[model samples]
Target chain A: MRKNDMRPDELLKMDRRLVLSATGGMAAVMLPVVLTSFIVSETARVVAAVLVYAAAIIMAWAFVKRYVGILNAQHRESEKKHLSEIAMLVQPITTHLNNRALIIPVLTNQLNEVTKQTESAALDIGEKFMSIVQRARNQAKKASGAFGRFAGNGGSSSESLTDLSKKALSDVIESLRDMVGVTSQTLKNMEVIIEDAGNIKRIVTEIEYIAEQTNLLALNAAIEAAHAGEQGRGFAIVADEVRKLSDRSNAAADDIRKLISRVETDIKGIYSKTEKSITESSARSLEAETVVNDTLRKIDDVIGEVKKQLDELGAETESLAKDISSIVISMQFQDITRQRIEHVIEPLMSFKAELEDITQKARSMSEKIHEWEGNSSAEWLEKMYTMESEREVLKEVLKNG
Target chain B: MGKTVLIVDDSASMRQLVSFALRDAGYDVIDAINGKDAMSKLNGTKIEMVITDLNMPEMDGIEFIKQVRNNPGYKFTPIVMLTTESQESKKQEGKQAGASGWIVKPFTPEQLIDIVKKFAR
Candidate 1:
């Protein structure tokens, strides 16, 4: 039968048996005493019987009290043993909690160092990046401005490449125009020389005609002198000499006419060649001017493209600097994480302390385990919370629980 | 030379964080492990401000603030409590112990700098 099912008498049967056995043995010894007392006198025998009954009752009471005392001692010993066992079981858990609590600070310290280093590095990177970007921006601006001036976009006082190219091309075109003007003037002078050559040819033709006529006249005079015979011998000799002079003059006139005709032909040939040269030079000058202008325009376009690219580079660098700043700002989470870990460490340390107290109490078995009290869970939860979010969670838990 | 600020906390990470923020803001920072250590560091230095955490060993922030208030040199120095404790009772205790301001933990660098600029001499 289960112990709870036992009757009160059955539960006390051992004590009752001890009391009855003691009473029975004492009564047997007391009965002989009472009978011996009867030999003295009736009153003495009655008093002796009463004394025997009292002695038996006293002996039974002492025996039962001793047995109960032994049982109580055994129960106390068992309780102490159980408490010690509990202490032994709890010791390792307390130690583990203590170790965790002790190491958390160390871990946080190391984390702090790591975070500090990272923050310093990130800040340094940001500062350096900003500095570099600033420098690059300044350089790019300068380059863009210079290119603008070179491309003649900005109204810079200094001569730009486009302006210079235009000026040089203008100078070349003006020089070509001047050359064409000079060639035209030369062609006009050639025309005047051709006209003068015609006049010289006409004069030479006139001299040739005069010389031929004089020769004919002298020949007629000589014939007439021959017909007059001896008397006109003297006149005939003179006419004959005149005729020889006329013949020589006519030959000289013929040479002069031939020379003038060749001179006219050479002057006409020079005029025709000079006119063709002037026409070709004018065409080439126009082509050269067109090519120079087109080249200048292409150069201007290239400079514009370079300036645009430089501006984009500067903008991109500025964006990178902003990103670095954001990264440096994000590093603040390390401290927040450290606080959260500390919250955990605090509870573990408290638990360790309470466990240690319990273990000490259990070991001694002098203090009641139920008497021990620690901070309430709510109090611990409230105390451990360091952040608003944690407090909100606590509120939720309390509200729900 | 910049203004000097002292940071007192038991957690190394917290001290580092506060120190980093203050230093980044161009303030000279001196850090101590706890209230007792912080007290020892107050030796005639021209500390413009003190930011400390509560629940430190050797001496807590409240007692440290009281001690600082007791000292004639630091009596009027602005002491701001930087701690995890957000309870009104703790805040009142800190205020009564002569804290000039209170900042909960996990504060942004901007907030810390703003408070420093507002209070530091």
Candidate 2:
């Protein structure tokens, strides 16, 4: 009989009655009646011996049988206890196995896919960074070359700084575009997974519904098999088997439900990740755009300021020209005063000449640096840096002036 | 060009997975269900590498490795033990039984391929 089919109360009832019956009336008859019949005679001695022996044997057999039966009952009780323990452990074990069995495959597939995605992402980021570095390196080389030129002959410095800023801005924008591409592609893939998971959830729920129907059908079959009584013994076993399988299948469906829920959760997680990645990419793009705009604004502002300074220098230069013209024209009539003015004017003109050369070199170096930034041309970059250092010297001369 | 390898494990699914990865990495592969069956396949095959499980029935992997080592057909074959168990005695036994290397189970494709490439023909 099936363990579940047996009732504990009924078992206890039968066990108690069995132990009591053997020691009761059977013991009463076997113990006394035969001993009382024993008499003193040769034939009677044999007959009495036989009767007493028979009583003892019967009583002994009954006692031993009861003891063994009780022993068996105890053993059965222990076995039942063991079964319960096993049953309790069964859920976790089955659940664990079921989870592992599904999870291994699901995660394996996800890991493979995600690894591919992340590797590509990392590669993309590395490539972007390298490109940015290359741009910066080229720009630095140009500035160095301008400095080398400028050091050889003093030149302007403001233009070179502006060129470097523009190149940095454009390069950053390019890398930002690549990052955006990767982020969008990843988001698209994640969306597809989310849709697929949703579809799978729907299918799993349908399957669960069908399993519930199957369980009900199996129950009806079991009831029908029961009504058949003796004729349905084989049918009942078959029905029971079907019912067991259905219950197991139902349990399997529940596992799938849980798995589907987990998958949906994981998909949502991935979606969130994709969203976060996109958000980060967008934010980076925005930051890059802002940097570029700010750089442009700084360049324009510096150009405007430099132009204003150059205009002031021009006005000063015009006044120096007027003073020289006046001194040359009136020098004979006012030689002493004119000579003194000439002494001061000569140095001022020398200063103006030096300033003009410095400013011209600075502009040349800036152009070379800008060219290198655009074409990544090392030759131009080398020239630009040489000019930058010259620009630095000129700025010092102007400061002294 | 890459190493030619044979993977012997009882699980069909695991075989499919490992082979998929190894093949993806450009390795030639042969497959078998278990140790006994692996031996039978090994007789006429020229597999340069063998990655086998430890706890298979009917001629377990260790015994198969021993027999393979004894046979002239595979004396120099590099045999790696792949299994889930981590008992020290089991590892020692595998090493004494002539295993070339040992790796725990649930390794990634990269890890598997990384190890395989180290001895792959």
Candidate 3:
């Protein structure tokens, strides 16, 4: 029968007293005949009456034994029915507890494995985070060091590199200007020297003209002296000497004129070359300055970019370090979580233990109930006591849970 | 020459992390799976410093430190322990075994590097 359909009180409510009372009434009716037969007996009759009374007593004893046997059979049948009902009441509960006990270990093992994996994963993540942040910090420091060294070379921190290069270029240009000025002055001096040479050539020409006239005057005086005879001879001699001296002086002036002409030619050639050289050098200088300024500007742009990158790297490294630290702290949560899981496992284990106790009790109680129904009354009562001990254990499980 | 550091840990990920960090900081790194592996790698190789985990299979950090200290070539080498064990007694055990210092688990990269720089160089 279903546990819900079987009531213990209803099973135990059977009345055996009605059969006992009917047996008692049958015995009382048979007793009066045996007493009358004993009262009328002579010697032979007395023996016969005694025999009838003995037979009646024997019949009454058999009837009482039969009634007791019928009652014992009914009691045994009732006990068998009770045992069946108790087994039905406990079977499902025992099966349910057994299944729960079987599942608990599996669940606990899975939980432990998950907790272990989580801890491992958290530690792994923490390590990776540390590595990344460390790499970033190192790179930042390197870049910053390189940038500092580069910028430090410029001396004053506030000075713009472009301005420094510009100032250097301006100095070079000023020197070029001084060189150009000196070249211009040298050309002017060459011009004045050339004009002085032209003036000397004209003076030499006038000397040559004076020498020719003196020679012509000496020729005329010589002819007049010849007509005057001896007095003219002395005058002719004086004119010849004066003509010779004048010719010599003209020859010297001619040589001086030729030297001045050569000197003026050389000075003119020098002035022309100097002027061309100055022009070429000035053009080259300006080209060089432009190239230098362009280069400086490019260098300035590169430096600015490098500095900006270094600054950003520094900031990023700082941010990464903070992020890594936070992640490292977060890894601690795994430890706490594992501990919490352990706490959960503890209760689950206890529950499993209690369920196992209950299942054992149910199985034992069912076995004892079977033994009680099969065994003699004395043996059945002893087994019933053992069943009560099992019940107490099950009850304890229920109370603990 | 770049500075060389030995990183010993049972966890492959942890070893990778430490090696990467040290390499990034311009130091050359030698990786070992455990203290025993670290011992094999240390033969005749010049190591400036060592970073190891305390709990590991085969050989632990304390014993590794002791072995490193006993080696004539690495007598003065600095050894740092990286571990989950935070107890003072455990720390003392490592220290007694010749560890230069110790860092708890989940330590920041910066903290690790700083210790490395101080001890390694």
Model 1 score (lDDT)? 0.72
**CAPRI-style quality class for the chain A–B interface of candidate 3:** incorrect
Task: Give the per-residue lDDT of model 1 (tens digit) for A1-401.
Answer: 34464468856975576677767776767675856664678777767777776776687666666566555544444454555556566667656655665675676566656656755654455456446645765877787777766766656565877687778887988899899899999989988887887887787677767767777877787788889888778887888787777777767766766776777678678778878988998888878778877876776677667767876876776565444434444444554555565676667666656756765654444234322211234454565566989989988887886
Candidate 3 per-residue lDDT, tens place, B1-121, comes to: 7999998986655666566556656799999988899999999898999998887779988889999999999989999998777899999999999998998877666787899999987
DockQ (0 to 1) for model 2: 0.01
The lDDT values for all models are 0.72, 0.65, 0.78
DockQ of each: 0.10, 0.01, 0.08
Q: List the residue pairs that clash in candidate 1.
A: none
List where candidate 3 sits over 4 angstroms from the true fold: A1-90, A101-192, A195-305, A308-401, B1-106, B110-121
On TM-score, the stronger of 2 and 3 is 3
Question: What's the candidate order when arranged by decreasing TM-score?
Answer: 3, 1, 2
| TM-score comparison, 1 vs 2, better candidate | 1
> Model 3, range A114-149, lDDT digits (tens) per residue?
887986797678677877886887888887766666
> Model 2 off-target regions past 4 Å?
A1-161, A173-188, A223-238, A266-288, A307-401, B1-121
**lDDT of model 1 at position B121:** 64
The superposed Cα distance between candidate 1 and the true structure at residue B35, in angstroms, equals 16
The local lDDT score (0 to 100) that residue A64 gets in candidate 2 is 67
The fraction of correct interface contacts reproduced by each prediction comes to 0.12, 0.00, 0.05
